[model samples]
Target: MLSAILLFGWDFAMRTYFPEDETPANMASREDAPSARADGAIDVGNGSAGIDAPQVVDVDTALASADRIIIDAPEILGSINPVGGRVDDIDLKTHRQTVEEDSGPIRLMSPAGTPGQHFAQFGWVGEGVALPGADTPWQVIAGDQLAQETPVTLGWDNGQGLSFALRFAIDEHYMLTVSQAVRNTGTGSVALRPYAFINRTSANASKSTWNVHSGPIAASGEGVNFDWDYDEVLEEGPVELGNGTDWVGFTDIYWLSALITQEGQGASGAFRSTGGETYRADLIYDPINVGAGQTVTRTTRLFAGAKESAVLSEYANQGVENFNLAIDWGWFRLIAWPMWQVLIFLFGLLGNFGLAIIGLTLIIRLLLFPIAQKQFHSMAQMRAVQPKMKALQERYKEDKPQLQQEMAKLYKEEKVNPLAGCLPIFIQIPIFFALYKVLLLAIEMRHEPFFGWLRDLSAPDPATILNLFGLLPFDPPGFLAIGVLAVLLGFTMWLQFKLNPAAMDPMQQQIFMIMPWVLMFVMAPFAAGLLLYWISNNVLTLAQQKYLYMRNPQLRMQMEKDREEKLRAAEREKADKAQE
Candidate 1:
């Protein structure tokens, strides 16, 4: 057990310190890509990153130029590539590339020849069967537009009596249900394995930090495996984990493109490199034998869009196991999930994500209010017994354990819970961290407008003071990018610290005086919504402190007494220095 723990710790530390760089520093040449399959389809190993494909136009130009079927869903907008029936071109209609009015919709998946090459492909591989290849331009037989209300079907037929059709259906959100049906009209039994995979260029992926997983991610019956990132594929070539693969795909920080396997179907998934910084997440099922005139249909769900917490959770609730974890809520998800629900509810009520965050803070404060009361009461009791505690400490100065024991005895006798004052802070730490993770990971917080000059709460504050609130053209670096929210945060934190009694230790007092400003500088680069949350929390803390002080007169008196002593001690030290 000890060795396991130590091994895990060492692995974690290595990953944390030396996170794999998503950049293709050791990328193989495009010419070295795996050969095309016997069926003329891009080898499943060299999936759809299109390493050998020629360069094409820009994203918009590429989509406009392609002979494609339109995808006009509520939140997703793209085209289905008729060639190979690849769902290659996608843009999030609800999300934008930037906050600018003309920034345009976020380009989620672009054509293979384009820079943002990301897409999902579904087909079959079989022995003694003629399968549809990449060059096969599937004919649109049913629907004109692939919309939520209108489902589209693309079909192709091999000369050898094998008929293949891909029926595509979409919901109001990002889930695309792909039904791949193969009808064996021949005389003999046809054996083929149905498979789907998402392929993308690692160059376009969001940076995969050790904490927030990007690159290849998948979920099985056990749980989601966040271990294999693009770096592993870029370095190690092909990698496969334990089987029972439920879903497999590539995930960015805000976006994801996963192929969820059919329920109860035994499937194997793996990540592989197709050379030139391209990676693929393959979901392959066991081969099934279809006798003459038998049609085999496989349904694969493609999730390609923003990783909104609520949407992911909804999918998870509907039986997509661990789908909610796509957002990487981390260890604090117990608090984060409920907090996210409350935040969503508040947003619906308040009509602003930023306001909803403030509302959530208020709710957290309310939930911790009882603890706050107990904390103040404990502090008051401790204050009333301070002199007695000091006398006991002096008497047992040389006996450390005895001093702690006596202190516990004194607390019991005085009906004081000495540790109670710390309980609130301990509780708040996880809550605060949970909120931080929410702000960082939730796509719902992306591009949300807060108030004046505060657009895109997920981004750092734009009205940076160093640039004179965007009045001046001067752009400062990250260290100097103090914004209005950061200023308020520092000021509010200082006020909160000042509300407490002054520390007796000079160094500790100095640290308290400097800590707020230091934290302000450190936190300036965080999301504006997070800064807003901390500022709101600090303001509430000040109010709570005032009310608690009023409720505990003895505590207030103790605070005053401590302040006076600190002042007198400073003056006496100054006099001694002057005499010297």
Candidate 2:
């Protein structure tokens, strides 16, 4: 119930304050989005809202039939459309769609008219002059293909002596440099403002939730901003990103597509909602006056690729302000960043993500070993004194203050701190949250295999008991999908609890007894790696409990006595009930 409330609160907060969380079914085409108006005013939005939709076709047909430039780089592979000159078709070479070996590479961008139409285009927006639209057939005059060492230059002529060119260059990773230029050779001077916009439908975007932000994200001159959600953009209309806007774009859990304006250009932008369930990020520069035979050029970089941590950071260090912040680390970034580094180091050393996770657990356990030892010894001491404590409690049943005082004295005499066991749990809260964020956001962990039947550690355990681990024909509902690791987690936790001293309150003891199974059901749908960690921790705890028992014979003896007495009392009660 508390978790539900927190989630609701988070959603409410994002909707109320930042409100950019929305998506629609159809989108107004780029041709409909005239960058400027005839009244000598700049709108940077759709002129004729929701008109001239593209023909719906499969991505393969669209790419095969169109005049496009192939993108062949170290990490990226895609084709650039020539008609609109949009970098739309992109797929990661190394990342696959699923754990299956035959699964295809992960696609990052798709062309317009497709079900997942997402693309970035650079062109001119001017009044009283001809400009390139989505239908402008651009000719590649410089290079046949886009490679790390080779760049492609696309040119277009308005037939009125105005020549336009878009130079495209790519790095080894994901950044693409698009330089937009306009040359005036007609008899008269022309005023033109260069603009770039990323248009997409929300139909295929990742679900936006309270904690993990999806949709419009930005890095202003001040810092990285995640406040503008989709709903706000739809309700409030186009959001004007004032001057000092460094970069702006859409972000998913593992993907990002943004436009970074040139440094010191003071380039401004806005996120506009075209009539359909589509949106656009427009990066606009001031209008430049080009005299006859003169030219104007503006350079902007488009980043459309995976949000890899190391890659993002490297870009950030090279002057793309707060680029790494694209990977939402939450408020616990201080702890999470270091933890991520350690995890990466372990993965490098172990060569398997599952083994790396186990190694991380071992390291954490070793670090907290001393505290846990103290906790167990303290618990044992407290248990050894329980009989005396209970006797005093009964004597002072009507006087609670007196009971607490005597309890404190008894605890002091026994050298046991009542709160010792709680310290380790409190210490683990930050570590647990850090791991949760890291695993959920890291694309590198996706499709990583652990062991038998655990092909994807980032996903829930696929083998569930309800279906006999795939022996049966039916699949279980989420809550009932108890997997092998979950079962082991429950048993190991229950065993560890059974070794501990019994709670004085019957209700508390019953809760402790049931908690393991409850957690097992609750956690069955979470990532297998998280479950593996808990299971490993529980097993270590049981071993620690056993070792501690040997070191404290009195505590072990009392536990045995308590168990036998409880069993004998249960038998007597059963016999009495039978007689009655």
Candidate 3:
């Protein structure tokens, strides 16, 4: 009952807050989709909102002054409106160096009913879809058409003389390509440092209120580690944004991310998106160094993909390393993962889960048959001696020690072992645990239904509904499935107890009566697939036990005869030895 309440509460909470998948027509119905400012930032909760300004760097001055650009925003887009300028102190040898983009923060304004927004920046992982700019500013002069305004010489030091050509180009995919051409300009060898930087505007108060979600990935090799983090964000607050560490998580949602860095490698960095109306960013960097007079170059890609799994998969294939599974609990994945592959292989040939479970159970029973047979025979021997044992106990009533000794002697004489009958249960426990694990985690069963009312193999059977006074939330289905199986279990226990008649132990009787209900309650939350398997096993066990009992009714007699033959052999051997 408590479990049912918890499940219901969880469902209620999800529906009340999070936006479900919506279509464009219904989007207007949802009054909750917040708007973004000319500057990137979301206004949430309050009517009025504001954020910090972008750090303006004069790229021409930066090149002339040998200064670096601090990439502050989590995401940025090339200015749709370009600015024209020239590099200071450097003559334009029919050349130019400018920082420009078609847009800055890649804003996603979808037509879907569930309004959504994202910014393009560096993904948590450094290798996938990435943002332009590192920590250093580039020489700039924005124009309608792509052109180089200045050429700067790059080297390890001022005089060492290994130089590279730095060129920028705007490509078809909203891409800004930065290329470097290496040249050995001096007698001495030199290596150059390559880096980039980015900055973004903060989100408005309403936008800040949007929730934030991220996915993480980590890789460790050769004592070096890298952590890739990516997720969705929606919240209500002053959004502090940057491509840096030390950011608080978005609220009201579950998150899964990976963090990778080499063990013992001290690397510290942060990606901050301080504030943006619809902030999203993906960053990629290949921190490769140019060898002495030997130039090596690298490139990165950026993407603006939807949060859907299939869309994410496409971007991921395009080098977005932090690909996350969109559906937290996928409809079919859980049932398909782990053992589902194996199950499918077998089911293809055998064609039934029921048959598979039975076959598996039969194999287990056969494996335990030796121990089980011994136990059953022992119980049978004990049952056969019950009459004599009862008589001895009554006759020796007041002589407790004698009664016990005689009972032990009688058990030995009859070759009975009390614990033998418990072997089946002992064997069944491990099989139960193993089968339960397989069913619980196997994704293949998620929506795979058994016939009638058991539509989802991975979920609890939902066909049962009790509307009267809210008694049981779900009524169990099919007498043969639940009721009949339970009855068979009870009958089997009763028969076993009858065959091994105990001496009126009140505690034992009470335990026997209470156990079945306890087991039923324990199994209530499990998937119907698992429950059905257990029920079938119980039914089969009952049938097998009945068959064994009827076919070998004098099992105890045979055991006693074997014991007598051994005793007679020992006596004859003793007499022969004496005569000799």
- Which candidate number maximizes lDDT? 2
Model 1, CA-based lDDT:
0.83
* 1-580 per-residue lDDT for model 1 (tens digits): 4433553465577778998665432222232223336653434545443334554446666577456989999999989989879898888999888888789999888766666777788888765556875567899999988999999999999979899999999999999999999998889888788888777887767887766888889888888888887777768767775459888898888998999988888888888887666777888888789889999999999999899877898999998988988888778889988888899899999999989988988888888899999988887887788889889989999999999999999888889986787898899899988888888888888888999989999899988987788889888866678899999999999999898866546789988898888788778888999999999999998999999899888889899989888799899999999999
Q: What TM-score does each of the candidates earn?
A: 0.88, 0.89, 0.43
Better of 2 and 3 by lDDT: 2
lDDT of 2 by residue, 427-454 (tens): 8888888887888889888899998999
Candidate 2 runs further than 4 Å off: 1-24, 27-33, 37-41, 46-55, 159-162, 184-191, 287-294, 405-416, 571-580
lDDT of 2 at 91: 95
The C-alpha local distance difference test score for the whole of candidate 3 amounts to 0.39
Q: Which residue pairs show backbone clashes in model 1? A: none
Which consecutive 10 residues in model 2 have the weakest lDDT in total? 46-55
Error of 2 at 544 (Å): 2.1
For residues 160-265, could you state the per-residue lDDT of candidate 3 as single tens digits? Answer: 3543334444322222344444445455443232322122222211121112213221211221112223222223322233323211112111211112121222
lDDT of 1 at 313: 81
Ranking by lDDT: 2, 1, 3
The 0-to-1 C-alpha lDDT of every candidate, in the order given, reads 0.83, 0.83, 0.39
Which is superior by lDDT, 1 or 2? 2
